[model samples]
Every structure is written in C-alpha cells, then in structure tokens.
Target: MFGPRHPLMLIAVLLIAAAPAPHRPRRIVSLNLCADHFLIPLADRGQIAALTRFARDPEISAEAARAAHYPVSRGTAEELLALRPDLVITSPWRRAAIAELLRGRGVAIADVPDAQDYAGIRANIATVAALVGHPDRGTALIARMDAQLDALGPARGHGRTAAYWQRRGFLTGAGTLVDDLLRRAGLANLATRLGRPALSRLSLEELVANPPDFLFAEAGPVRDQGTELLTHPAVLRAVPPRRRLHIPGALIACATPAYPRAVANIAAQLLAADRIPTRARSQ
Candidate 1:
C-alpha cells in the first residue's frame, strides 16, 4: 500500500511510461494483394479481420487457399471501418485513395512496399511480421526461404535467354520481379536486351523475328481475348510448345513466400529442356 504521491509510486509511473508499447494488432485488415500474401502466412488467423476479395482467387494469390478462410473487404471506407481494424496493410502503388481515406479517419496504416527482387521480398516479409508483433516469425520465414533456395542450388539457365511473354504480347522487362526470377534461374531477360521498359507489348511479328530460347507463358486455360493471344499460331511457331514453360499465374502474381516455389519451377523446367536435342531445344 503506497500513497499516490509516494516516491515509489512516482518511480513506478515513470517506469511504465518508459516501457515499450505493445504492437500486437488483433484486428488487421489487408487491402493490397501482396499484403494479403504475407499476412495469411505470418499473422495469426485470429488476428486477421479481413483480406481483399482477390485473396481468395487462386489465379492471383499464392495463399488463396488459406486466405479463403478469412473475411474479405472490398476496401470501401464503410466496409473497412465496420471491421474495426487496428492495422490496415495496403500498397501505395494501388488503392492509394482508399488508404488515404482510411488515414483521414484515424486508422493506422502499414504501407507495404513493392518487392522487385528477393532482397526486397525478405524486407517486405520482415516489415509485415514486425507490424503484426511477430518479428521472430518473419525471421523464421526468411530463414526457411534462404534454406530452400540454397538447397535448390545454383542457377540453371546456362546463359539462355527467355521472355516472360504474357497475354496480348506484353513482355516483363528489367527491374521487375519476373526479371529477377529469370536471373535467379541463370536465364537472361530478352526485354532487357531489347531495351524495353518494365512493361511493354511486343507484336507477334517482332516476337517471331527475335524469339528467345524459351517463352515463360502463364499457366491457365484461355478464357478471353487476352489469354487467347498466348496460344495463337504465330506464338506457337515463334517459340514452339516444347520451349515454353507455363508457370502458374499465381506464382508470379506477387513476391511472397511462394517465390521459392516459382524459382524451383523455373529451374526444373530449364533442366527438363536441357535433356532435349539441341535442334529440338532451339525449336
């Protein structure tokens, strides 16, 4: 029993003021797709308030299966406020307006940066983990990713070039996650060699005139005009089916824990291509 103004009471008050603030956000909401990727694996399931609707779509999200279990928000202010999120994780690249709106209302925001390479990936993971009050979990996830990459061994591209040819002839260029992934597999990005920007479209004729050793096509059914172009006769002739590696759209959709999976898949595909005859391989 100490009096209110006692020296011991005063010291206790000062100590309490100096203590670190708790960072455990119990009601976290994710507005960015990339944020959704990291949130699903790092944050406790109970800590999550909601994820974006895209989080449940397997075609875009690597953690779609797990994210499916969480509630989803369309990112509308009303919807987000109703969830009473202690932390809102989002990207400044997209949904800046929504994030700004939320901020004006006094919501705490964690702006997740765009990860263009593996180092960025590690940083993003760490940032999200710490935000969720689980820095150890972030470190562990990064360690696991590093270990898996080491076990996977060296790059297997063998100086070959490839183009991440997307629907409608769009080529993924330098400084992008796709380009970094290509380098990891020992392959060079044709877009960089051509002096193309981060995202640009190459016509069918240009593709035929300067075809790379391989075409990194998106894996999925042809569902529309965009996807239809991927399977056009011109594309098949420029880079034969045998020389094409159809990676899952979800894998490259974002830089997340699934990055290792994408790397492994690329390396495996390149290894398989090695066993083929030089003439057929070039075809």
Candidate 2:
C-alpha cells in the first residue's frame, strides 16, 4: 500500500485503475432493406446515420414511418463512405457491389441474413441488436414476439387451407417463410396440397375449382386485369368477397420483428372470416 506521503505513486495507481474502455460504434449505416428494418427497432435514432431508400417506402418496408426520421441512402459507395459509419450493416446477397466496394476501402461491415422462419428471425434480430450494442433490446423484442404468439394459444393450424396468391398467378409455396407463418397461425398452405413449386402459376380456373378455406389476395385494386391476375374476373367471381382478405406488401415482404404482427393480422382476418354467417358468406 502506498503511504499518504507518496502522492505520486497513489496518483499513478488511480489513473491506471480508472482508464476507460475503448468506445463502440456511434454511427451505423444500413445498405439493405432487411438491414434497415433490423436497425430501426434495435438502434437509437442517434446511432443511425442512414438507411436504405426502401426504408421510406411503405410498400416494401414495415418500418417506413419509423425510418422517415432518419436520412436514407441508395447504397452508393461514395455516399456511404462519406458518413464514415463506425459500423456498416448490409446483405451480401443484395447490394453486393456496394458491400464489396466499402469493404475494399477498409470500412467495417456486417451482413444481415435472409431469414425464412421464426428461428431465423430471432437469430437475425439478436445478431443486429448485439452489433448495435443493444442485445437486451433484442431479447426484449423477441420476448414480446413470444408473448404475442403464446397469447394466440396452440390451437392454430386447424388444418384450414389458405393461399397467398400474388400478382401474375404467383403463389407462395411450401418450405417458404410465408408458408411457415401460415402453419404457425394454424393454417395450411394450399401450395403444398397442390404440389406447386416455389413460383407456381395458379390459373383462375384452378383457383376457383380448388378454393381454400381462405383466399389471401395481394394488396391493391385491379389496375389492369391482364397483369393483375388476382383481380381476374374468374377469381373475383369464384372466391367469395367475404372470404378475401388483402394483405399489404409491407407485412410479408420482410422477416423482421414486425413478423409477429403479420401473423396476428392473418389470424385476425381468419377469425373475422369465420365470424361471417355461412349463408351470407355463400351469397
């Protein structure tokens, strides 16, 4: 122990003990749509330097409104490098050129995975949160998602068949993210029963002939019947109006924390359809 008379020794020991740890990233930049969604809920607004332009479009991003407060980028190397973010988040699958360019210039970058199931979603949320110095926030968000799912009870997957029919006769197939969500919500995907591929074409005739318990039509009205197959006259006539529930592009477009909300939305729609009187539904 240093004696009171030895002031120099005591001062040196105190300075060494109180030395601060290195600082973490203060500014983060996202170069992909999924990465933007991950950053929005996990990082503080101040931590975010810029999000991709998709973050501003509600049609593709579930966090459009939340992202409005932050500056957005188009993933240009020059613009991204200008921000000098402490950490850069992106998807190697997307914006590959930009990701490569930034990395070549010695910028810190992390790739966000493309999640196809609940497990993937949780892993992604946790990954992003930890990188942003908010692992607990990720845990809390996941817990909330779990609580929401638990509240839904285990009675879902009543074996009721559903279809995520999109534009141009495109149907969401089995072993896909939407399919997984459908099963979680207690509904079976029609694509599996139909034995369709990932991008199968379901003609209006087949859709009408084998109508599922529910018909999930894509968002928007029939701007052009030739292109917008969901609005085909046969589909409109065969699928009962009450049986249809249009899902916005934003909900199923990404596998983010908002995913639980999508599940709940579908469940709510199913419940609403069930509530309709059989006679009126058939009319």
Candidate 3:
C-alpha cells in the first residue's frame, strides 16, 4: 500500500478503464408499417423491442409473417415509453402527440416520410438505413430497385387510352403516386386527363354518362359499407362487364419495393384487355 503499483500495471489498468464500450442497440420500437419494414430487416432480432400490430396484417405488410414474432405495440406514447426503446422509428402519419412525448424523454426518434412513389420509396429506404447506421446496405437495396426499373424498358403505348380507379371513390390524380405508377405501366389516368386535382366523389349517373375505357376497383372484400357502390345493380348495369377489372388492394396501397411487381401485374392485365375484339368493347 505504501509503494506505488508498477508503471506497466497502472498503465494497463488505465487503458482498460478508458477503453470505449462496444455500440449495440439494445431496444428498438417501430410505430408504423413502413418503419416496421425498414427496422425489422435491418435490426438484430433481439434488438426490436416492439412492432405495430398492423405490421403483422398481411393485407398491409409484405413481410407480415416475419414481423409477427415481435411483441406488438399500438402507436401510443405510454406504450412506447414503457418499452424503453433506445431508438424509435415512425412514419409521418403517426400521431403527433406520441412523437412529441418520446422526443421530450430524450429518446432518439426517426421520422421516416411516406413514400409518394417509387423514388420516394428509395428515399425513405435510404433515410431509414442512415438512421440505423446501415447506409451501405440501403444503397445496395436501392441499386437493386433501380435495376428492376431499368429492366422495364421503354414504355409501350399498348394500354387503354383512359383508365378509371374506383377505390372507395378516391381517384389517383396527377402528381400522386398511383398516377405515376399508372403512367409507368403505360396507361393514362382519366382523373388526370379531366383536370381534377384528385378524385371527387362522382355519382353512378356521372360515371355511366362518361365511362372510362377501363374500370378498376379493389379486388378484395369491400372494407367500407359504402363500397356497395362498386357492386350495386345499377352500377353493374351501367358498367359493361368487359371494362371492369378487380385489382388487389394490396397492389395499389402500399408503396414498397413490391410496387414494381404490382405495376407489372397491372400492365399485363391492361395489355390483355387491349387485345379484346372491338365488338366486345364497352358500348
């Protein structure tokens, strides 16, 4: 005790004491489906503290099965805070109050913007990658996406002159992601052609009077009771059967890497419809 420790031993002790600890994310909470997509694929299995229940809903998420294993959390401040996550990821659409509360607690919150189209999807992917410290992986994923787009080749003018989207009376207009997807698939959006900012609810009479060359509606069971408009006898009588196509809601709603595949599916259907005999065209 009276003598000083050996210089080498003291130096070794100081070096051990001053050494930086390894960085490992201990807890992560994802508040939205999009964030679920980004966080689940990138984070270590045990690192994910919670995920949204919607993340396991196949209708909304492409990787639902993978996301189902994690504990689910609703987008509530108290629930998220209880998880004590080191990092939280959410979409812009998440409740503002929850985001505020988390930020107030000094937790790092990453707000990923909603993707309006394919490009926006890439941007969101990159942003999430950077936030999670996986910038290179993000770049590679986007490169693969760009490669897929490149494979689509020049757009052919084989689609119908006008196409109608009949999803819950909401029309995808110019400057919207659906409109851009339609254009990429070689179809002209009737909503855009009519100079409408987006879809204004139109009556069955209006639709019958000026029918689009093609009528596409959500393929699955109607969610809203009002969706009876799609199958009303009057609506059916007004629309020629040959002009209608049922597109899966999953194809059009989530703007993810799977979106290009959805566009391809739509384009294939449109091309097939174009081959129908003129006699079969809607009168």
Candidate 4:
C-alpha cells in the first residue's frame, strides 16, 4: 500500500482544484457587421470589448453612429485576443483560423448563421437574443417585425405581369431572395422564364432586343456607369424607351430587418416608373 500524503497538503490541492477558472471571459467582442447590429443593442456598453472597424462605416452598417464609441479592431485574431474578450460573436463566413485561435485560448465563439429569408432572419434575431440573455427582447423585436410584415397587405396585382431586373447584367431569377422581395412587391421576375438560377448574366444587346414590360436596373455609385448600362448608346438606339427604375444595390444585398423597407422602397419606385396613378401606389 502507498503511504498517505499529509492532510494539509491534500487540503491545499483540493482547494486549488475547486477554485473557479481564472481565464473565463466576461466581455464580448463582435467580428462582423450583422453581429455588431444584433449584439450591440442587447449588450451593456461596459460588456462590449470590441467591434470590427467596418462597423463604423454607415455604408455597410446603419448603426454606425451608435457603434462609433466602442473599441474597434481589424478582425484579426491577435487584435481580438488583445481585447481579452470572454466571448466572440462572428458570422459563419469568418476565417477558420481566427475561430480556432480563439477556441484554443478558451474563448467562447458564437458563429451566427447568414439569414437569407424572413424566417431565417427571425431565427437569427432569437439566436442573438439568447446569447445576450435577452430572449424577451428578441420576442419583442420579432413581434414588431411581424406587425410590419402584416401591414404590407396582400400582394397587389395591377403591375406589369413580367419585369426584368438588370444589376450589372446579372438578373435576379426565381427562388432568390430578391425575387421573393419583388414578388412581395407585386412584380413578376422574368428571370424565371429564362430557366436560370439565382442570377444570370445577359448582354445589353439581348436585353434591349427582348426587353420585358418593366425594367428595374440596379444603379451603382457613378451615374455615368449606370447611364451607360441603362441607356447604352446601342440600347438607346435599338430599344424603345419604356419604364425604367433605378434600385440602389445595397437594398437588395442583405436580408436584414431593413428588408421590408427595401421592399417598400422598390414597390414605390416601380409604381412611380409604371406611371400608375392609382392611390394603391402609395406603399
């Protein structure tokens, strides 16, 4: 039989083992723009360790002004570790190495899924809410969103039956989020008839030759570039001037809570372009 250790020594070892881990984190860091939006509102100002630098750019984040006061980093693992965050919230699309490094250092990592539709967006809001111990807030947010969506009313049927969306020659086809938004706004996407996926590239010549009743063009920053694409000299010469509307590219990119606003804007723009004088055009 082995000799017994001293009672004092054994007691000291047990006490040390029972002590809570010192490396556990109490601060949270956000690594993406969407996560920033979800987490910032849920977390206390003191609890937020850092946010990505891009979080301050209004072009990418609508809550930039509110986020400007927080500590910001370039989304590198080294920078994240320097902040000593207990938890890191990031998009699923973040680099694997950053996640691995944080995990290796015993930091909790929450990889939020990309919300591609209305349901997915609601689920994502709940997920973020749970992380910040504010599930009730998530429910409230969802309720508000539901109310907004419900107020949209049934899809109207007065608009042109077929429409083409030209975004730098890429068309939004059936089954895509943009297509869903268009359908919700009471416009038919012509891309589906062409038997294409979410997006398909079509030449300006082809578009002019077989133009749909309505054209929604996504104009970029430069008016000249958009003018060249929409009013291409060849296209201007060939196709008769019909109804053309410009939709800012940002509105159609992300499936966020602001999507309903985007849908409303697009619907209003379409109604204006269609010259539909009915009061129903006041979306």
Highest TM-score model number:
2
Worst 10 residues of 1 by lDDT: 93-102
Please give each candidate's TM-score: 0.86, 0.86, 0.78, 0.75
For residue 76, give model 2's deviation from the true position in Å: 1.5
lDDT ranking, high to low:
1, 2, 3, 4
Candidate 4 positional error at 224, Å: 7.5
- Candidate 3 on 1-283: residue-level lDDT in tens? 4267678788998999997653446788888777777776666778889988888887877668887788888867778778998778876656466566866676777777767788888887877777766677778888877787778776643455444556456656777667777778777777776677855666666666666766776555667766766766666566666667655655555666666676766666766766888877654
lDDT minimum window of 10 residues, candidate 3: 156-165
- Scanning candidate 2 in windows of ten residues, the lowest lDDT window is 93-102
After best superposition, candidate 1 residue 90: deviation in angstroms? 1.8
Residue-level error in angstroms, candidate 1, position 73: 1.9
Scored by lDDT, model 2 comes in at: 0.82
Over 1-283, each residue of candidate 2 has an lDDT whose tens digit, in order, gives 6677689988888998997643356888888788888888888888899999999999989999988989998877779878988788877765466556666566667888788899999999988888888888899999999998888766444898889887777788876788888888888889999999766888888998988877887666677764577766677677777877766679778888888888888878777877889888864
Candidate 4: regions farther than 4 A off: 1-26, 156-167, 220-227, 234-242, 274-283
Which ranking of candidates, highest TM-score first? Answer: 2, 1, 3, 4
Error of 3 at 24 (Å): 6.7
Task: State each model's CA lDDT, in order.
Answer: 0.88, 0.82, 0.71, 0.68
Check candidate 1 and list the clashing pairs: none
The residue pairs found clashing in candidate 3 are none
Winner on TM-score (2 vs 3): 2
